[model samples]
Target: MDLKIFSTLPILLLLYLLDCGSAQSPPPRGCESSLESVYFNLCDLNAVWGVVLEAIAAVGIVITLILIVVLLCIIPFIQDKRKKASVAIQWIFLNSTLGIFGLTFAFIIKFDQRTCPTRLFLWGVLFSISFSCLLAHAWRLQRLVRTGEGPSTCKMIGLVLVLTLVQVIIAVEYLVLTTVRLNNVCSYENKDFVMLLIYVMFLMALTFILSTFTFCGHYRKWKKHGAHIFVTMFFSIAIWVVWIVMFVRGNAELNKSPDWDDPTLSIALVANGWVFILFYILPELRHITCPAKKEDDPPENIASSQRNPGLKGVDNQVFFLEESNRGIALNFEDNLHSPSYRGPSPMGRNVYSSPQEFTIPRPHTRPSYHPTPLLQDPYLNYHNRQTTF
Candidate 1:
């Protein structure tokens, strides 16, 4: 229908012709209509079904390639040094190994040529990179807790290197064992389930270990920084867990039904949506941990903030001094009287301009008021002192 599809038409026709030619030439040992169940082959593939499967797988392969390319293109431009390195290395692993090679092998490669060992090996490599990144994430958490610094490139690189090595070893062992056992193109069912079981157990163990460490780190953050980090970590881990669970359930259901209508795909679609939300949306949802940088703010903005010209509450000492200085003017007003004499004096009765205002004396720097004796007693020396004064 489209140019892309039209371009692929020739290749698809060639593949179909090759399949037909190979079928006509091949009649192995007792592999005939009798042993149909024992050796599963593409001879059972209906024309429509085969075409549809190829289209769907092709779409998947294209999407995976686009994601890899986008990641590769974006990671280099990230500004944060540590995050940039982590993202770069992570994109390299995802693009080159997990996305490109794995998708090509799983979806684009001819079904008859594809082997169980190859699928398992690719899966191991895929999960290994994912798990290693997760472990590095855990290690970063631990480092942050012990010392208040973020993750380093050394940490990420080391973990990725170790994980790649381990995955390669496991893949090689399975490859060797399968080649020995199958002695030809290997099908999915005839592969050793025990080796896969062991590998899965190892993966699960590592996942659990990393998860525990991450959880502990989250717990520590919750204790120290309230529940903000806890909520963020919850969303991150929850999304990934959902993805894993959906994948497992989907695979199991596909094994049983072999139909594309298995609910696992829906769950996987949901998980992917959540994963994007966790990575992109959740960070936007949460408040930034770091404060604004100096360069981000303007100098004029700082000056405006500094120039807050408004009156605040008066100080007690300043108010007291002002009140005291103003007290003498109001002391003899019409409604006022001395404390010792409640009855109004002649001076207090006048509300008009008082004589004190007409000829106001230079105000005394200090009041000359002194306390008088409480009573005139015979034993006291008050009489003699008064006479001398």
Candidate 2:
């Protein structure tokens, strides 16, 4: 009986192999009978997450373009050399962020050998570019706060590119090792993906820590920059935590590990890109592009932006108005309530409660006809001359 069963096992296995080979699975939803079935992961608008992410990334791309235009347009108007020096970093930062959004399209499409490696390689590159630019910016802020200046535009740009180069090398090595060496292009595990991003996480952590150092300096005006960086890094850290957990453990626990991988990464990309746009990039663009006020500006002819003698009195002067007609010197430093100053005149509202209007006294007049004895009215002088005659 055992020999007979063994002989029939070979035939049964062949039949099962043929049956399994003949059993064809249905195409992906919203993909059947479509001309774009080749790349239906993106073209399949019926896939809710793919459609939503595509729309979001499209919007982000448009907004980034508009901001780039605005940044370029405002560059000519930016008078401060420090701010002007920052333009290159800002441009690099914004374009990297745009790449982040644009790269989302790769993830939205179906995963193939080519798409997989492209996604893996570009993911760290774009993120590294953005974080390195941010690192340079935050470093500049700290330096500016401490020394009241920053490095030249060339030096800052070089620093950013150098920092980003490290990640590029790492990403290239990772891509080659995983795709070419191992011959596992699209089959790379989730852990492998996270491992490839370790350098990027290090950059992010460094950027987050460095951003806080802006407060250590004396200049508090730029402390708002620290706050902005802090918040952006904070939320980014949180988003990373959630996605890493889902990608590493939660998806497997829920029995959706392989299926959820694309959505997990796609969602993280979209969320973090928006965070960059909303938290860091928009605020930075607004700051660098704002119209300069006269008080904050140095004279046009002066070669040095530091020789701001005009700002010296801004802290001390409570009310200041410069008109060439009549010099009404209202020195309120002596007394807040000068006796001559009753109240503010009804012409306009006064900032201070008591107005310091200097009252000039009228010279004494002898009579309506003459004031000085020698220089009396012309008629009186003529009469006196007639008397003399």
Q: What would the per-residue lDDT of candidate 2 be over residues 1-389, giving only the tens digit for each residue?
A: 99999999999999999887666444566666534444666656567888788889999999999988998888888866777888888899889989989888888876876688788889999989888888888888888767667778888899988988998898888777766767886677788889889988998999999998988865555677667788889998999999999999999999997789889999999899899888987887777756555554333433243566666576333232222112222322222254543343442233334344443322234556342223322122322433443
Clashing pairs in 1: none
Compared with the true structure, what per-residue lDDT tens digits does model 1 show for residues 1-389? 69999999999999999999876664344335444332322223432333344344445555556655666666445553434444544454444332423233242223344444455566556546655554555565454443334567776778677866787787777677767887653544412433453543465456445444444432243122213233434453555455455455545555743343222333332333234334432342232223334553333454344464332233544564455445544543422343433442344334325534443122333364332223122223423443454
TM-score attained by model 2: 0.68
TM-score of candidate 1 against the unseen true structure:
0.43
The lDDT values for all models are 0.45, 0.75
- Ten-residue segment with the worst summed lDDT in candidate 2? 320-329
**Worst ten in a row by lDDT for model 1:** 370-379
